[model samples]
Target chain A: MTANARANILSRLRATTTQGSFAVPDAPVIAGLALSLEERIDRLRRMLETMHAEVQVVSSSAWLGALKARLRARGLNGLLYGAETPLGAALEAAWEDDLPPLVPYSESVEQCREQLFHIDAGITTTRGAIAENGALILWPSAAEPRLMSLTPGLHIAVLEAGMIFNTFAEAIDQQAWLQEGMPTNALLISGPSKTADIELTLTFGVHGPKELVVFILT
Target chain B: MTKTADVLAFERNVTKALDDGQLRRNLRSAMTTLSQRRRALFADVEAFEKLRTQGQSIRRRALSRLPELLEQLEARCTANGIQVHWAETTAEANAICLDIIRRHGAQRVIKGKSMVSEEMHLNHFLEEQGIEALETDLGEYIIQLDGETPSHIIVPAIHKNKDQIAHLFHDRIPDAPYTEVVEELNAIARQELREKFRAGEVGVSGVNFAVAETGTLCLVENEGNGRMCTTAPPVHIALMGLEKVVEKLQDVPPLLRLLTGSATGQPITTYFNMITAPRRPGELDGPREVHLVILDNGRSSIYGDPERRATLQCIRCGACLNHCPIYTRLGGHAYGHVYPGPIGSILTPQLEGLDEAGVMASASTFCGACEEVCPVKIPFTEILRMLRNEAYARGESEHDVKGHGYRYTTVEALSWKSWALYNTSPGLARIGSQILGKLGQHLPMIGPLKEWTRTRIPPPFAPKSLHQLAQERGLDDDR
Candidate 1:
């Protein structure tokens, strides 16, 4: 039945003769494509901050310490991280007894769904960032599950400065996303979850993370 | 659910909407803020026009090859392990969804913001089958709670103010406190919907853009509910109008930017999720199964006509709704369709036919504000005029629009035809005006002018015809 329906619809569309072939135009140049690395970082930070997300620029050697300090300062109980990655291993190595517990996403969502929803914060490493819209591109994998940047109340993302692109098209092009098959889910997260649904009042953290803190490894 | 589809009922709804003080205030403030934000975001006129042209061309290209692109999209999605289904009508689409749910044995279905689902009335259909469908978007959730259809497209609950929402939450939710704070109200909804998301067995969503090259479904949302509904549930189903398909992966960014910026004046939404396939092997978390349902639902007819196919170029941004003077005055409820405002004026008539919805085409004032704000540059004034023409003259031409000649009446048609004839012949015109100038004001209010005179004072006609006075003054033939 469905096959017949598909054939009928397609045949109807094909039967109708339309005029003129649509010529696909060349990709227009996007703004902010010519900014320096510093300019790009500045643009991203300003835009994210306007949306109420926090950003901190620190050296790769100091991001973990900054992450710990920021989490402690916010009084978050535990920080969720992926134990399979190098950054996760480094955090695990630098663990201190008095610091907040670092919870690793080691189990399937079915087994850890309850804990994930109640966790204080979850941090994941971003594949890259878009400076034009102030967004972080995430390619969720098995190690860092899709929910790491979601589910938790506070989401902390780690981005290297060099990975920042001036626009989303640039990120897609530089990463060769067309050549490489897209992951099950690819996301561009600009700020924490928000809505202006109630009388156009801007409210954050309606469903996803309330706070999105990015640590740019300079 | 509730529908005000017929011509009389639509006019009645418009009258009632126009009289509602609270609704008027809410719509006025909301529309102003939305249009202001969009203008502020696209402040650079030159840059904005360039993006609009590029966006329009992209949509035109996709629609020009809609069938081929849809086929490519299906094959690519199937290769990516995502099941694709086709439905020629809304009923078929609903049945396909129900079948998917039955196969999964899913009792709880959570949905993100989907206008397509609303068009199918999927929630109402599911309830009859003893399945519960929960709305996860905050605006949709509010509307679902009250058993009301969405008034606006992007913001479903834009017609309600904070105080109304506060009262609603306090009355509806168990042990909920009455609070007018926006943040608190949002938190209450978050808490209520989170449990549903956690337990949702099947997730349903609307695809914003489906890429033919990568077979990806892109969803744009500011709230995280879209993510939860698509990601947390074991089985995910996405519904889309066949027109939503795009050409390639690169076609996404430009459209996405225009969509979010024009829809909510956001540079980008909080989340732009691209779903290529279901959970891959060894994937710890993601939907186990993904299904894409492409629905025609009168769109194929709209696509058949070369001139009318521009209707499909709309990205459902709601910018037209925000800027329309008629929409702002009467609100979306007056239109009495799933879509409202200028786009609805042309779309509902074509989709539902002129017999049931032809009156909606006359709802516009031909202000051209909708065309000015449309991201894809849909010539709305021209389309509305075309639909109006089809409504009155459906039998006059071989047109694909449904319900042609629905509004055509012998008396009205004859009156117009005679009026056209009188204007072309000076002898008949002078004779007609001589009679009208003598008895026009004293004649009984009848015909179409009967309704016009019921509200407005009739204008007095001069005793002397203009042509008579011109000849009395000895004016030349040219004058």
Candidate 2:
């Protein structure tokens, strides 16, 4: 029955001819003009800031301290992240001082569901950044699935400076998004969860992260 | 305006909406503010126009190859481990969704804001089957709590103000716990819906754009409910109209640009989820099973027509609703359906058949603001007129309207015919004017014209005819 319905719809649609001919325009590979990587990163930071996200660039030697200080400032005590991630390895090795519990996403969600509710923050490594829209494209893999970015109250994303692009088109084309095997989920997150539904008040943290803090690797 | 065993009286609906001063005030202020935000975003006039043109062409190109693209979408989505279903009607769609829930032995489902689900009246259907479907979007949640349909697409509860919403929360919940502060009201809903998301067995959402190339379904939202629904639940079910498919992934950005800029004046929504499939092996916390239901309720009939096919190009932005003079005044309830405003004025009649929903064709004043603000540039005013013509043709036969309705009675049509005849011939026009002048009545309480004169004073006839006065002044032009 489902196959029959599908065929019926396709047959009717195939016979359809719209009133006028339309010339299909070529989708430009890059929507905005190219800029130096430094300029692109600055623009990305500025745009993300405009969307109410906190952004900063730090040298490799100073980033871990900066990350810890920023997390403490937000009163975020416990951290949730992917254990096998490079970020995790660096933080583990850098911890000569006392630190909070680092909950690994390697645990299945059901096993960690109760603790996930109380965790102060979750962090993930972004695949790249789209500078024009201040978006972080995270392609969910087996290691870090979607919930790591969404379930927590505060979401902190780390992006390398070299991974920034001028537009989403460039990101897709440069990465060969579809040609390469893609993940089961991906997202273009601009800022924290927000809503203007109630009398047009711009309130954040409605369902997703209340605050989005980004650390750019310089 | 009351629902009575599935009978819809559009006139009564309009009267009820117009009588509520709060509804009028709420819609007026919100629509004005929304359209202003939209206008502010298009400050770059040249770039904005170019983008709209590009958006329209993308939609046209997609529609031009819809069957092929849909086939590609199904195959690619299947390859990505997403189970896709096809339904030819709203009944079939509801049944399929219910079956999926039954398979999991689930009795509770959480829903994101989906106009497709509303069109199927999915909540009511699920209730009958002893399953609870909770609306998670804040605006939709408010309307659902009140047992009402959405009054507007983007802002579903645009008809209610802060006080009313606060009252609703106080009245409906177990205890009247919160004040009417806007942020507090939002917090109340957030606190309530969070537990529903965690406990639900299945999640339902609407697809904004289904990319055929990557088999990715794009869901856009400003709030986190969309994320929670698709991410927290064990099984995810997505509903999309057949026309929502685009051929390539890159075709998305231009449309997304126009949609955000035109709809809510944002660069991009906060969350853009590209779901290629359910949870893969060794992954945590996405739906274990993903199902995509493609609905074809009355869209194929619209596709059968050539010129009317352009109606399918709409991106559901609600810009048309904001700009439409009639819709902004009447509110969405006046349309008496899930869709409202200028798009609804034409779409409902065609979908429900002209005989039943044809009165909507006459709901417009033929203003072009809807087309001017439409992101994809659907010719709404022209379509309204075509539907009116179709309504008149249908109204001519008693059989066509036997179980449905008549937009215009024969008496009204004949009255307009005689009125047109008098205006064309000067001699008859003079006699008719002389009779009205001698009667000393400014407005006539006669026939279908009474419906018009109820709210307006009929203009009195001149003391002398234009032809007569022109000849007396020696200014009559002989053509």
Candidate 3:
């Protein structure tokens, strides 16, 4: 049924034609996507490493200390991310105490969806990995709304060691919900929010999260 | 209406904008904010590149078969009770809009932010025709009130600071107090525009994507102003550039995703209004009459030209503006045209004529960054290069001499023998460089060289060229 739906969508798209008043490129001569899964992952990892270097990382407890240190170091308020329930608690406590704006995670995906609309940060779990591209498949369950992954300035993702797969297709295959006829909305996040908007001036954080952090736990 | 003569006059305007530190600060800050937001949103989306490729392909397909799809769209729109008008030029487009206004007896027009309208200078034309046109978008309204052209494609009043806007509002509204708060100012603008929307007899909007399959016009906006403009007024007129047509409705999702994501870094904008026609009999709210004016305005001429046609793929997300280094420093006013940044550098010359806006071609650093971030993959740098060649062909090569009075006429304008003699011979070129270097040292700050020396010193000639050095070093001796 899913395959049939996808085919229907593709056919509908192919059949539709635009006005002949403008010039469009001929069908894209797609150079084969040459990079292997491992090469893709390495490229992504390198990109992440560069991004991480720009940010000051803190343990779940040392978030406030890290924030203060980052403020002193960069002369700007740094984004905060927490790991688990304790991190959420700390963020909530910080918000109450008027520290820095910390993005909090919810147990319920629907609640996460609501929070996603107005959040400064997004926290989600990576279900699998794509080796060719350093892509993490974040399953958009009820707790992890797709918007949460988009709207925030900072994205803090928790990746359990065992859940990482080699490719997007492999990750999809592992999803029991797909076999059970459940809908899936997945996000693959790699880096911080960035735009080459000015004259190709690389500006960080326009309408989305500027910083992306992934916490890998064994 | 021909901006050919005004291109030279824009230098003085650019000088003024350059001096205004406050305006520069506002532009820099706003662009920075928008850029960062876009980057963050795209970071996690692996399919972003794929989506961009898809968008490019879809737009290309649409453009390749535009005439047929336009007919289909016209048929569908007319069947759906919408009126379609084809305009060959800006004047024709404006006149058509004015005729619609006259037919409706509309005294006032409420407009959403439409770059096409700006390109046509529709507001000024409408005011001259004795009809009041109110910009409903907050940023556009601010610029309209100031009697200024939009500085940025996405954020029209991006050059205006909060305090400046607050002051403008205080001056305009009798009882409104000055406030530095942005949200407060937005609320005030909303209040001011709401009244206009309710009283407005006609609404004018720009189409983001026109679906040929269903004759649907899609509008993506953060504010509900577009919704108000399209629905509240009795007559709604959608001004679409001929290039905005897309083949199918499904192809719209990816393009919309790219537009909103690239523009505001949101996965989707607050409102995505897709209107096929005027409200049907049972509809409670919507325009009674829908008029879609498909404006050619210099687009059809470039349609078959392979080198220039890629300009049509632009989605106008303003991502290039946000990330542009030159735009960050000089601001949009430096280009002295409606569209600015990488897109503007290539587009302005094409639409307005290369000879008319030749100076704008030099505005780029050829950074290739615009191409990198472009959702539609418009090779802005390559297009700018083409425009530069075109500009030179039209005798606008004075700017290309690298310094004042260093005319390329001796070689470029003279015989092909002169060009070949200077370009092909390595020994002669080296000797010339050596002499120039010596002269540069001896001639103490004279002529056009003075301006060149102010920012950078010309390097002395080396005994061996880099190619020679590489060859001596046992590198590939291709040179």
Candidate 4:
């Protein structure tokens, strides 16, 4: 790239950042909004039912182990059990084969970001679900880079038994728990990446991941 | 090159396409896949419809304020240090492009896929002026080498299968062997295009949408060729239709959502580059001089007619093409125009002129499927009907004689009025029907009933009319 070309790109970038032309309408921050864990889980169940997507719930440590075993049986790779396990050891264990390695758990969120750029799939916790648009929101902080959830083709998100909401408005209204500030990144993934550009012929997995798998842990 | 009437030429081409079973199969398979993908992507019915309405209204609003917006866009673009040029026709647009190339002393041009350029036949014109124009997009590069026009809008070389592509590649490349694998063919083309991208002096592309507020041009694509073409050359030129503009930046997201979803059934394309101006002093990878050529070949005239004004809402997603039954059967080449689908059936005639290209208007089943799937919600079937009416008025229709005969016999003559009066009174209508039925049975063939009887037995004239039958059955008289 020429110096002139680099200057042009930087100038355009500066102009855009300073112009504030692409600013979205600022969302209002509300206080004292809360939902019980059971209510959230139930709302999620209803939304999934409407979309004809399946949902599974697991609670016991023994059952979680069995679920991992079953996922392996179904040809899913990089299965790592993170509970009571060192984050580094789990990462190494997940990297056993040619199949995409998965981390079962991370002791620290920072470990997740280090492994994110190379991983093909990520199973992470969702802060909450918005009912209005049927979206699952994930926040990226210093511990977890935004790229981990976005770069992968398959995002297997595990929501706690009670974090789902009925609408996106409700999800936005319920963001009072953060102590420091909003995370640098938030991804609202609704479905898999798809395309129908070729002769209007639909082909999945053009650029983004072809599939999205979400699990609810009771 | 051909001076034949567009409708007559189109009819001949469509007839040939209908006979090619292989082409029909390829189109059908591709269309089916596209329709399924679109269906999956737009599962949220309410949101999808809302977006469609928004897109339609935005385009309509933009067209109403087009002249003003174009002036505004030109001013802002010029202020941003990008040169803007206006062309009233394809000839003018081509001349301006050539003049720019000549001024820069450019010998080689690498082009991204721009349908407006295709409409103007810019490649041929440029080549005539002794400049090499390379199509950098993979699909376009293949068809360029094949020496054929693009068969589809989004995917240019859609009609050709892998085997045919392999054969074409083998013939074109000196050392490359013919291969069926797609990756190998792509690699060969990639290798061939990389040199053009590196060495070309001019880069040309089509603008998906030009933001009037900030004087930004948006190019959305899955392949990286558009980026390469825009950034590789010192001189970058964009040929945009006058209709491809939106008022503000916020309007862009909704339009993008609809365009990407309708075109490829994707939420968004891989690359959505918003280019504001030419490369500034410190930019690493952008053109030094950016030129935007706004072409209004025949669109201004279209905006004047209320019946055809809705045609301007087209985002060129080609969803109507995928769902159109006639288009799937006939393929793009059969349309004998740059656009070749449901939208094409209505738009081509208007832009090219109804007297010459109106036959395409009658090609629809009026199933309303095109309108249903249209991202910008163009009332395609209704526009088609209006075009057909215009065709008939100009005596340009193949069915003109039949249409005229019907109009003369039914509308010009008052015999049908007398017949209607007789039918109004149930007793009189029944008696007349009985007489006509007796005459028909006795004299084997005669009058208006003769031709009707020759094809198949006409409905037997009943002794009792429908009203009497209804009354006898105790149904409501009004019904």
**Which prediction has the highest lDDT against the true structure?**
1
* Candidate 3 Cα outliers beyond 4 Å, as residue runs: A1-218, B1-15, B394-412, B415-419, B423-440, B443-448, B463-479
**lDDT, model 1:** 0.90
What is the fnat value (0 to 1) for candidate 4?
0.03
Chain A accuracy of model 2 expressed as TM-score: 0.90
- Docking class for model 1 is medium
Residue B138, candidate 2: Cα error in Å is 1.2
Interface RMSD of each: 2.1, 3.4, 13.7, 14.1
Mind sharing the TM-score for model 3?
0.65
* TM-score-better candidate, 1 vs 3: 1
TM for every model, in the order presented, reads 0.96, 0.91, 0.65, 0.64
lDDT of 1 by residue, A1-218 (tens): 69988998998888764453334454455564679999999999999998889999999998878877766656677889999998799889998867779999988888989888888889899999999999999999989999888899989999999999988998999899999888899999999999999999999898999999999999
- Runs in model 1 deviating more than 4 A are A17-32, A73-75, B1-5, B394-396, B462-479
| Candidate 2: residue A188 Cα off by (Å) | 0.8
- On DockQ, the candidate that comes out on top is 1
The true-versus-predicted C-alpha distance at residue B238 of model 3, in Å, is 0.4
Off by over 4 Å in 2: A17-31, A73-77, B1-8, B395-405, B412-444, B462-479
Scored by CA lDDT, what does every candidate get?
A: 0.90, 0.83, 0.65, 0.66
Tens digits of per-residue lDDT, candidate 3, B113-193, equal 899999999999999989999887777888777888888898777777777888888998667789966656655675575
Minimal lDDT window, size 10, model 4 chain B: B398-407
